[model samples]
Target: MVQDVTLVDGAGSGPAAARIPPAPLGRNRDFLLLWSGASMSFLANRVTTVAYPLIVLWHTGSPLAMSVVSTAALLPLLLVQLPAGALVDRWDRRRLMLVCELGRVAAVGSVALALAAGRVTVAHLAAVAFTEASLAVFYRLAERGAVRNIVHPAHLSTALSRNEARGRAAGLLGQPGGVLLQSAGRWVPFGFGVLGYLVSAVSLLLIRKDFQQERDPTAGRGRMAGEIAEGMRWLWRQRFLRAAFAYVAGTNVLFQMLALALILRVKEAGLPSATLAIVLGIGGVGGLCGALVGGWVQRRARQRTLLIAGAVAWAVLIGAMGFTREPVLLGALYAGTGFVGAVFNVAAAVYQVRTTPDALQGRVAAAAGLVGSGTNALGSFAGGLLLAAWGALPTVRAIAIAMAVLALLAAVAPDLKGELPDDGTDTDAVG
Candidate 1:
């Protein structure tokens, strides 16, 4: 029931083109509700992400603890994701999302209680946060995978944009909240996170349609791991998608390396948490603009070229983060990097949504998610260690050089420069 759409120019002289059938629910109804709920969930999740680190720092003052939580949160993608994706395809996506939200609600609420009671241990909190994050990744996969079922394909660009917009909005809210909450009580944001999850679950319950297709009585699925491989196989056959996945996974290493370095450098420079918040907020604005512009750019440019440019920009901006200690300069760099990165993300999202087959999207997305996270995990771990070893400036410089080399190569991928096939061959390959 994905909404179908037409992308005619606003000017009448451009000519009218009929799009496919509209989304199952009109723009302002069920879809908006879903959108609002989803956006809030993102905001809440980010709040927890920021709050957790500060809480750990407050309790243990240990960089090692931050590393531990960061590792626990991300490594699940490498280890547990194949089965998670397979499970998503097997379950009712809507119900699964609802249940997943409730699980987060309980987990965060428990953490809040434990923190309030001074009963929280770094180990116990890590377990809660990690489990909650793993579930969150699953719900995100289900949401993206189910979008095609909830709305028509023609409208996919719009739906995806809306989702990105929500995330940006959440980023705006959460970035500041995350920093500010540390000043209040480390436990406060977790309470908000619990509320957000509960509200998101309520929103899921209010959705009106059957988003999942009823399974055929005769069709039997194999093991989750087998299904995961099936998804990966489909991805590999698409030369474009394979390249895209590799590019995304590759760039993430640089992205998080820079981010981790920024935190270390900024904290060392005695910058206020508010300053960091501003940097993140401005970056969120850049992301907002990118999301708005990405669709049009897609219509006009080659995906690989734009994607490569974005990667290069990510590298350069992040390198600049280390070279300058001025808060204003850093904020500007963060904003620019965020804007370009958002363009990259929106473009990639479009490619994935259009190319992947609906039935297999969950698994494909999950596998893709794993690829992205696993790469980021390495970078994050490396970033932490690199900071401990050589200080932030050198690590940032190294990431910059690495990303520049990768972007240079990506721009020349032969398949990226040509016209797409008539039957959406390129789309499927990249998806």
Candidate 2:
């Protein structure tokens, strides 16, 4: 029941060549509602992410307690992605999203109430973080799968680009906002998070369309493990997608390492927390610009061109991180990295949306996420060890060198460079 419409463009030399430009997404009621809801949800989630440790530390006065709760929040990404993706594919995505929003509200709100009553403990916080994050994994998978269903294929790239911008904006503001709110009261940030969930739920209700294509009833469908296996098999069969997944996973590790190294460098330089925040915050603007330009870039260049360009840009920018300790220079380097990352994300997301069948969207996305995010988590851990063993500058230089090598190899991949099949089927594999 999603609305179907075409865009209008300027007339060509002949009237027959004239085209309708796609309705601006800002005017699309459903998309606006979806975007608003998602924005609130992402902001809320990020706020809670910032507040969780602050709350735990305030209560227990122990960094160990904070780490425990933080670990709990992240554990779900490793454990929940595969199964969550399977459920997202099998369940009514919209309804599942609604359930997730409500559950998040209850989880976060309970902690707020408990804090207000001075009843919260480290154990309480850890349990809540884990449970809420587990639900979030499902919500995210469902939303990603649902977006393609809600918009015309012509507009999908722009729509996803906007989504990426929303996430970046949320990241830009959420941490500072959460810390500011917490200054007023420990419970304030979580209360705002609860409000965000309420808003997201209402937005879901306002949406007037189904978010999935009709699936054939699978009364005797094999176990969920089988469904997950099928999704993985489909993803593996696409050489381009498979390579993309590996590429992203590898880059995620590099970025994670870079992040930790940057933080260490900043700390070593005795930069003020405000300066560090500003440095990090500046990177979000690049991501915003990248997202804004993603559709334009995709339209003008081949996917291979963009991929290689982004890779080259990434290597140069990240390599620069090892050569600077100045906050301003580091900030610029980070911004460049974020910009390239956003471009790659939008390009990759469009490819995934266009090529994957609706039935497999959730599963494939989840499978991809498992690899990318799981490694990111590992990278965080390994980054610390590398920093400890080799020091920040050396660790960063090593990572940068590895990145250049990887980008060079990726640029030469035949499957990446070859023309995609014109029939919209991307199954053609070139070695």
Candidate 3:
């Protein structure tokens, strides 16, 4: 069972008493446990993400080997999302999360042990990376569904904002932490992953709340394909969500192109590689700050407002990038975009969680994730081609033009006109 107690702002009567405020998320024990566990898991994932290529390059001295392992890690995002979402909906989410953490520990631990024995092969590394990533997919889907179950309805937005900030902080710290640990030993980063998963597992054990609503025993017995299709159909029927997904997909592709273009611009200008790092660090800080303020933004603005404004902001910032190659200026522009992205993410996540039924949370989230991120690889490939063909300046200017078009479409889209109610009730009505 989940506890969703409402906390009043102050002792009062009549309407004042009815105006129940949410308890601070910091005071929620179950949510704290969940957050801590997830924080560790996210940090661990980032640490290994940086270490994987480094380990392969150091041990095998083969960029091809590094690419193979990295590709293996990413394959789960493409292949596992749909099916994993289905399983997450059908399975006991808490138990599933426990299994996932244990599986990750074993997979990453195997790599550490192999490295210790001086017997790690590229194939083994690839297999471990794939397995670890696959488990992470399941864990992430389960966690997404579990969030709404653990907090009061009034606190959901704030909870999600904190989660977003945690992820940004992890990204900010994890890569450098990975590199520092690897300097201590090739196996040290993987050992850190093992420890992180163990901590996550322990936290899961301490949580007293259920991660989801009780399911009707007869439901979810359909074939996996059928379940997946049902989820897809539900998402397709939401006019606002459909429009939002399209916007996200387009912006994601454009961002990918911009990232690659930024690197090329720096290289072409004969800047030191550290300049790129400083720019990215600035962007990460900006994202963290945006996430920290996301709750405030969400409470004050409508979903449509955030979406349209974010698209417009991104367009302006990216357009500005086309006019400058200075490291500090590029960093500032990139950071602005990052801020907008984080705020948008928080708003979108709250809308999705508040509207979708608990039974469909995992499937809907997975489906939405696939639609949003499925084109990332295509975007990266296109970015490479565009950079090769037109050089960095022209490619960025072209992307800016495309983004402005996206912003225009967002402003005029009919489905994006009104605000969706966020009363935390599950409904099938189209937004």
lDDT of 2: 0.82
Clashing pairs in 3: none
lDDT of each: 0.74, 0.82, 0.87
Q: RMSD per prediction, one decimal?
A: 5.4, 4.8, 4.0
The parts of candidate 2 lying over 4 Å away from their true place are: 1-22, 418-423, 428-431
Q: Looking at model 2, report the run of 10 residues with the lowest lDDT sum.
A: 1-10
Ranking by TM-score: 3, 2, 1
Ranking by lDDT: 3, 2, 1
Which pairs, if any, clash in model 2? 7-20, 7-21, 7-22, 8-20, 8-21, 8-22, 9-19, 9-20, 9-21
lDDT of 1: 0.74
Summarize candidate 2's per-residue lDDT along 101-124 as a digit string, tens digits: 999999999999998998998988
Selected candidate, larger lDDT, 2 vs 3: 3
Candidate 3 lDDT by residue in tens digits, 1-431: 12122221222222354356756778889999999999999999999889999999999899999999999999999999999999999999999999999999999999999989999999999999999989998998899888877877667789899999999999999999999999999999999999999999999999988888766989988999999998888777676787888889999999889999999999999999999998999999999999999988999998888887888888788888888889998999999999999999999998887777778888989998897779898789999999999999999888988888988898899877644565432233524
TM-score of 1: 0.82
